[model samples]
Target: MSSRRRLLTASSCLIVLLAVGGTVVAQMEAGDRGILPIDSTGTLEIDGIHVDVGGKDAASARYAGWRIAQREGFKKLWAKQHGRPESEAPNLSDSVLDGLVSSIVVDRENIGPTRYIADLGILFDRARAGELLGMSGEVRRSAPMLLVPVMISGGTATTVEIKNPWQRAWAQFRTSQSPVDYVRISGMGVDPLLVNAAQTGRPGRGWWRNIIDLYGAADILVAEVSVQRLYPGGPAYARFVGRHGPDGEILGGFDLKAKDSADIPRMMAEGVQRMDELFTRALAAGELVRDPTLITVEPPPPVEDELAAIQPVAQVPLSGIQIQILTRDDAGLNNAVAQLRTIPGMEGVGVRGGDKGWSILFVNFRGNNVTLASAIRARGWTVSDVNGTLRVVPALQIPGAPSGQ
Candidate 1:
């Protein structure tokens, strides 16, 4: 099941109090999204550790190599949690995770009489590993966020629609020790295709909220990674810059230098790690706050459920209600029109008029003004009935830079 669906199940009877009203609200984080999850429920994979063994026989040599791998695996986990790392690791004479090592695969190997050399992958029991790391097993994680991985390569920019290697890299990004909770929304359909590189720089609460709603996320994070290579075969350099909504952007970017194409994975991993650090610091400093406007209400309850009885049936009959909507761009305009048609009483949407900065939409809705307004709100939009006339804002994610430092 999706994380959002799981969240709804747990919060079935709970209420989301209005938080944007200046009250000190704590972000209720769920699921695991840390660089090194303090308390992992899934398998803990440790890779790239080298082992060398010299024994009296090939059988003894293999046994010795396996022992070294188990010890080394625990050491890597320790160093990850403690960034400084220790030269001498504590002896694991009686670790609970001793017999819990699920699997060990050789990455690269060379063998000779009475000797063995290999790089290894060790899988440890996640729960036990957390205990060994001395973690409380309760690290607060960030909200589920939609990541728009923008790739600038070969003198051109590639978004989700373009199908580039950079996008694939992000798709395959493993959050082994990362703090960022990335919600990998697919780039299918027209909406994703419409998003371009220029959109990342722009922002509007309405547009962002709409986009966030579409992907069932609470926020948006833009990871702009530009990759470069000197010639036919040279080291590749990846520069990562990140910004998030609603309004905390890191000013500078860090560069990841890779040995070659084979190192792209490492570069991407490093980039995510560094980006996670910036966000973690920001979150701790109280600079990163969740947007209350983006928090969606619970989905409609099932017909067979008792909770459905409490739902209001504020249906309004056809009344030929006409309204005017102002949109920032054609994209928003189309999005607004599509959403408007989803309303029960909304009959049709016609273009009354339009221009560069704004457009006029005639909403042929059948419902009462109040019902129509509530429908818009449920869709993460704000509508107004002014002097018996309606001014509607469509629920769509548009792009623009807000007055954020």
Candidate 2:
């Protein structure tokens, strides 16, 4: 073939490859493979409630066990709250108990023709139970903190990049008893692209601030677990570390071992409980304070004298305010755009295309460029106006963020 023909063929192949890549990315975005967190909010969960009962049939036996679990769980909850023995706990009718119990969680169970033996979790309606205990249900909680459960195995660290037992344990944890207000994300949609193992290593508070704000959290909690497999289907050990903030200040750490692969879930559950305890203690010690750099302190009001001296200026809404976001890839472009749309006064935000490593977004604002810049900066993005075009930069040196086209 001629050189010109060869060049044309290669260009066509490149276009086809680009199209296929774009399709894959788009499909990943639309896929629903992420795990949704269990809803155990606003309920006091009493785990390790054991019940063994027998009946004429398997279903009847299971029902009897669940009823007995409600009674036993109530006693445990009373002792937990009042520091009394289970025998001293007051009794209520089965009908009343039914009203207080929210759901039954089967921790472990065995079923036979006429018997049911199980360890269970009982969720109690906090308000209803509190009324019976003659106390308030209110509990002091810390500022909202984003939880990123990182699992390290085979020298590789991952968080929601792939489903693992560690992530599942954290997602299933009941937060009603925890003092830390943990904001958990279902590792779906673009979650893996955003909250990954590499993201925890980023030390920029500015970048974290943006991410935390997206989740309506004030700070971050890094729950890291390193798994050590002794052998195939043998014992396993895991080291867990609870770190705080973008700097990864160590709150606490511990080690756990599982007897075998089947015991891994139980081990992970214990790890999560211990990790929550560490966070709780850290919060009590005032160690879980939000980073000052992450908080956006609004500009103070102008004094009366300064305000009086200022001349009134006509307000003009800005249109076609070009924002160039620097990005590493298409994911960064999507993230930057999502963050920008959250800022107030930005309307009809639309991408205007850009060269490699950057994307241009044109938005109509309800205010001027100065107000727009202030809003963008509040979201932890570095913004500057150059020749009427706004250049927005991410705090972390991540590619595909705000860079001019």
Candidate 3:
């Protein structure tokens, strides 16, 4: 890769954040259990269970006891970790437990009347299950994450509590357990409305600082969610954009499949759970420590503590869409991504499939086409969006002068 600088004045094409719908975790197997490893601390999963009992039928007896045994297993694991008796662990829900289980191992079965016993290895995506068990590892008070949840419904965006269910959920989320310090404005009392869904595309950090200060937060996470239902009162597919509030740089994007509108909040809440993990990982890896240039008040000096080490994370799934840059050379593409990262919440930029004269870079960013385009415009880049596909070029000189509106 050449580090050559081009005489490109600036690109007018706005940054594009794709709202990916459906299962957001890439290559994740069907159902709730994650095939990949997520964590190894705090919450202990009940894996490899060997229980034997006799009932009307071996299968039915063993099946019936599965629930009781699962609860028992969880309690046992909790007791081992917390030094409390099995009876001390909080009662857990069967439905919740069922979701965390990934692969079940069964072998060496013996059957009897209404009773069956075998070996079972019940795996779990401990990252998600731990929350249900109220077993959050450790929390840090270094930064207060300002929550700006914007819900887009009926083609309109809202932030006020009455209309935005996403924001409402964030406000209600118990942030005490998580490492990230969370801050949110209820839009109550004398609060001046400054941020909306659209401003996330702006290239500069000017607008974000005010919003951060409005809620007295150290930083901000713009939780942008778009909900679409095929039929009224039916299943819903939600697209989530988690971006930095400072510069609208995308931290990550994901999709949620909800049974219906009611489930949207649950899915969103889970999405937030992952978002916290991502942030925690970044912090643990020393990737997202405060930048003094970011805020007027600097974050407290980095405290060497055990909190960061315990917050584990899985392979972060990226939700992406690509844009074409007319200049595809190594330097041009590299510089393009470099510039993009300066915008704040950009997750990453990479050449995914192929590169023509136009660099086909998969931009893992947040926000929609409009916000991206607007941000590009702010940077003085010429942008063209045709049905959500973006093509951008420098404003200085082109053979045809950057075609398409």
How does each model score on TM-score?
0.52, 0.65, 0.40
lDDT by residue (tens digit), candidate 3, 184-253:
5555543324655555555455556766666687776677888889999889898887666466557667
Q: 355, model 1: CA deviation in Å?
A: 82
Ranking by lDDT: 2, 1, 3
Query: CA lDDT of 175 in candidate 1?
Result: 52
RMSD to native for every prediction?
Answer: 28.1, 29.3, 35.8
Residue runs of model 1 more than 4 Å from their true location after superposition: 1-41, 45-48, 54-66, 79-90, 93-98, 103-121, 162-165, 186-199, 246-248, 291-405
**What TM-score would you give candidate 1 relative to the actual structure?**
0.52
Candidate whose lDDT is highest:
2
Error of 3 at 79 (Å): 7.7
Q: Tens-digit lDDT track for model 2 on 1-405?
A: 101011111112242323564553442123353456666665788888778899999999988998898899999988888888999999988888888876777778888999999888887877778788666746789999999999999899988877788887887788877888999877887788888899999888777877888889989999999999989889999999999988999998999999998889889989999999999999999998877899966889867787779999776666668888787689888888888778776677898887877778898887877888999888787889998888878768755443444
Off by over 4 Å in 2: 1-33, 299-405
Better candidate number, 1 or 2, judged by TM-score: 2
Pick out the ten consecutive residues of candidate 1 with the lowest summed lDDT. 1-10
Q: In model 3, where do residues sit more than 4 Å from their true spots?
A: 1-139, 202-207, 289-292, 297-405
**Model 1 lDDT at residue 28:** 30
